[model samples]
Target: MKISDSFKSAIVEAICLLYILLFVYASVSKIIDFENFQVQLGQSPLLSAFAVPVSLGIPILELIIAFILLFPKFRYIGLMSSFGLMVMFTAYIFIMLYFSPFIPCSCGGILEKMSWNMHLVFNILLLMMAVCALLFFDKKSFFLRTKQFTVRLLLCTMISSVLIIILIFTFSEKIIHNENPFLRRYPPHPAEFSNAVRLKFNSYYLSGFADGRIYLGNYTTPAQIISFNSNLKDRKVHKIIFDPANTRFKVISWYVKGNYFYLLDGSIHKIFRGDIKTWKIDTELKDFPFFTRAIPIDSTTLVFRTNKGKKMTNTIGKFTNEQQVKVKYFEGLLQAQNEGVFDTDGVLMYSEELNKIVYLYYYRNGFVVADKNGKVENRGNTIDTIKHVNLKVSVLKNGTEYAISSPSITVNSSSTVYKNILFVRSQVKGRLENDQLWEKSFIIDVYDFRKNIYLYSFPIYHSSPAKKFSSFLATRTHIYALLGSDLVVYEIKNDLKKEMNSK
Candidate 1:
């Protein structure tokens, strides 16, 4: 039997209508993979020059138009939007195919879920549907009243698109610039800072110079003393400075600590004790963590943070059997909740008068404490435990006080040492030229939360032409400094070895 004319018309309309639904589904798929879609749009040769704004806005418009197209009443308005969008896509695909970068189906899971050949065929079929609507559907949809509405919607979308482009240009850089704020002073020259052991009653200072050199100074007469250096043999060091306050706080969280200097590598600790004239490597602790800062709470307990993503603690011991180095850790205590480590990656806050410190790590890990025993216990893990000292009070914030734990409770995965953070603000008066001659006047500030006060900031000017600067601070009274790879006595005296010899 021959098919009726009305039935044939209905069949054609149904097939054409499926394209509208498919278009809507595709638009939603793109929106779901919005990030990847934007990435693709930006890379697409069609809009690469003006890619950013288009990448951000086009998917929304496409989805809106696709939905409107499904209804016969608003079909004209939908066609207007689809026409503009399709023109852009056609241009994009042709350019990509011509130049031939060979895109491997980056349109998201939905588009890729269809086979590659099928995707191409489906796009062509959709284009044909749009054409058929333009030809036949245009007959009914193109009445004067409907045409007027469609034109107005297109005009508004074009105007809005231009405005979004302008806004993106005006403000996007500021957002990106904030992330790289330290591009100027960041990435100090590289120098090896490991294997630092404590030197008894010596004074040492280690600093990285604006010039490709490290400065090591030893003060003896309260300020004046001998100095030395260590030649790093041309390696890139990120940044360098003396321990912020010349104390145990230099090795915060997971840093290397000893009687001499503290060395904090990415995740390695090297504790050393030697004079600057004669170099020596003492104790090297690897893989523990290259902590940002660490301070000794007492003879037994230590607190610190990994230079990485976590804050940890390590408990000290008196050696039960003279075999294993006994230790425990508090994982995830100080969840770097402030400025998120970017603004203050290697910065510290130390207070002297309060005998306390509020150490801040990069990311959001920071701790506030009035004394050395400020720690937070997670689950069954005990953050801090004092031997002779009684548990007085452990406060989380200024308003609330909570108890941490009793003596000798079980702890795991905590760091015994944290990182030693350093913040140096360099101010120059005149125009700064190329980095070769660029000079930096260093002012250092540290926060010791155990003391609860911001300590003094000191200035470091170009002193002697440093041959090599490698020094470690054991304490305020003792220091081990290196000059040109040679060890020296860092004290307010004549010479360290000579004093030992003369005595």
Candidate 2:
């Protein structure tokens, strides 16, 4: 259809007005809130490296384009520039929504409130208008000039290709490492409370697990050890036959290893050995170092986190030879934390299959992997970015010692290692996460110790009204969690089980 030049000129003039207004508003908004725009750019996955330059250059470019479109002489060049910019913006949004794992809030001005998908549509509409404006400028000249058309096509392709290449490079690195990107996958409820049994009291804590039965020790009644199977059907309470009156001993913790059960008393600095079947104490290991945290490695040996006599921070060590009870301290594990007493406080887990010790900290995104002999193996990271404890201390009692204002817990809330698979109840949430998913249950991030990489994460629902989880343990097939006074058992999802097996 042959359209009149007058009608085409009118359409082109209207398009020019749209471009001028759009650019003016966009540039003014960015200039007014320049620091915020700069920071948002700095957080972008693709623009982070060039944030400072781009932040300064963007508004200036927008203002220049706006002024150029306002003048009739420069309107043609302005339309072309606006078209290219809109195409670039559209591509950026598309890459962010699909390819990139982390999408930072960086769209400025009117685009800020719009969703990424909506912003893409808005850019696309503007791009179409820019193209139409250019086409209407001189209808016969643009179509008749083949050389001009070919040059413009090639220029657009090269610019678009470069933008895509940049997006690919930035997106690939984060997607592969899975770093702190905070991409969360919620599969069909990975875990659920299938069964639960009410205990005698809230004081009952899981002491150990062996032969599919969970053993519990009471702080109120130190002489009793309660045993219950995973099914919550069979229950037994055994009165621990130990001479507490003579030895002045108090049970700190207990665990089963091999054919025997060991009871540790940090107050008396002694460990008592007994048969698991009979629940009778027969042998005593004296001169054992005072340990706050203890985990049984084998029948004759045990691992502990202790601050024995010295003023040094807590050290990971093993005690073997029941007769002499020789303490071999791990020198390598003590130097990692700032203050070992509280900041380095964490869970000491032992994998029976690998015979490796994993110390997961409560105040950082790092953990220590060590061999049975206290040799350092490798240090690993959690998905969280918190590297140090967020603790505040104040001097008390005339500056002799400092008092902690708020005891900081930065990373792993609770963790357990079984068969080379590390299960952690993470306290810190990651990026690109759903707050509702975290609110419903405890987030359990699984890591493969052999690979030292995150495998997956699953949710374990809260069993009580308080929405607090005291302790949890994962076995080969089942997960036992102490939720208030009820012992809850959740079956591990088949896919997560397979993932762990593959690792």
Candidate 3:
């Protein structure tokens, strides 16, 4: 069928409107949840600094591009603007692909309806429309207008775009925010401590923020379990684990569950609530500076020990604890025999599934697993009769017996996190379900004692290909891997969905 000029113009206009709608929705959603966006940015060496400025500006730019394109006189100008914006976006993607290993979900709300690849394609399509609009040029051309009028209009357009860009840079964070978030509270309170620490095989890290509140996230799932209120000093979070032995809750590293949280700053263990906002001073210790392990055996009991974690911020002094809340520690392996040898800073794992704490130490022999009860079970040993592979271990369940999962990989040297970039060293290959070294990207290796075979792996990286250094999160049903601004979700295999077993 032959289409008329009017009909064609209307169709083109509708298409243009849809693109702008997407842009506006995408930009605005991210603006509303800018802090989450910042975390994503921080995960990348290049994006964090760009986050504040971009967060405020992108939405406004979209609004402008949308409004201008709708105007009959400014149709071509709108098209040109869209083209420029798309170019900027495409460039951002390529840059992220190379410099950053993970990506974040910058698009939220309405725009999230489309996939990332589709989002890119849509932007490119808009660029084409902008170009097409240029071809449809008819009204009094800018060149044909009086020189004075032409100059003024041109000047006005440039000024408008410039102002918009500047606003994006200046108020990007504020405009998106309905309220001032930074001035508000952070680091949740610690109330009770679960008598357990956990090992997170994957990147689903549940850590405490400085505000005595819990801070947790993963790339695969949604609904983060975190709450924050009060300053860092007033927090108490630490826990002690047991191997079929019950221990009292004392000043330890950290604890997580519900209605309870204990934190150990360098000097003392602060006890607070996961459900409440206030905190109380738990008993202070003598060798507080040297204290490391703190595990809660019951509601009012705990066992305290000393083990330094990775970052200074990771100190129990810095983290507020809660019941069943997942936590991780660097735990440079030490010995009960030696009072203090060179502390071995090991893998950073989290409390997941069941309050089991699993950590990978680069042992002179191999690695070991620290169960919820502080029992270090050797996963691999440099000494014979141990597992040598540096596998990713996950804390599965809790109770008399615990469930743990590990996905091993071969890596070279130490992992690196440069600027905002994360470079981990791991080598494991497998497909999504089918086993093919050639086809698998990120390995999701599952170890089922029920199956009697100890091999399972899958790639859980999002935004980019699954690699070391990329951050991730796990939910009941899915896993979300964050690669910079990209948030990729992975649903568990049907067979492994609810088939958790004890080791």
Q: Which candidate is the best by TM-score?
A: 2
Better of 1 and 2 by TM-score: 2
In candidate 3, position 348 carries an lDDT of 40
Q: Which tens-of-lDDT digit does each residue in 1-503 have in candidate 3?
A: 76576775776577578667766776676678765554444333233335555656767788888887777676656766676676666555544444432344444565468665676676667656655555444445434645454346545554565454444334423321222211111111101111121224344444333323444443343222332222212223332222212324332334443444544333443433233233333333223243444444334444334444322221221122343333343343333111121223234433433443433333232333445445554343211222333333333344222122443333322221111111222332211112332233343323321122222123433223443434433333344333334334444443344443123
Instruction: Order the numbered candidates by lDDT, best leading.
Output: 2, 3, 1
Off by over 4 Å in 3: 1-8, 113-115, 139-141, 144-503
Give the winner by lDDT.
Answer: 2
The residue-by-residue lDDT of candidate 1 on 1-503, one tens digit each, is 86565564454366446656666677777778766665554333233334456655666676677678667777755765565565445434444455432332346756667654555566666656554454344445456645455456556654564454445433433322222111121112111122232323334444312222334433332222222232333333122223324324232211222322334333334332222222233433322434554543322233454433322222211111113443444333333222223222322233222334343332222333323334432111011121122223343454332344443211111111112222223222111112333333222222222222222122222234453233223222223334344443323122221322231
RMSD of each: 20.5, 7.2, 21.2
Order the candidate numbers by TM-score, best to worst: 2, 3, 1
lDDT of 3 at 9: 72
User: Model 3 compared with the native: what TM-score?
Assistant: 0.31
Question: Per-residue CA lDDT of candidate 2, range 1-503, in tens?
Answer: 99888998988899889888988999899999887787676556665545667789889999999988888877777777787677667777777788754577756777788988888888888877776667667745343544467358637754885576466547534453455444334444455566888874778777878887888887788778888887677998888777655776655667766678888777777788999888888877767788888887877788998863334467888988655658898875855445456666788999887889999888888888888998878788787778777877665666444467887765788888777788888877764455676777788887776777765577877644474677888777778887778788887766666654553
Query: lDDT, candidate 3, residue 434?
Result: 26
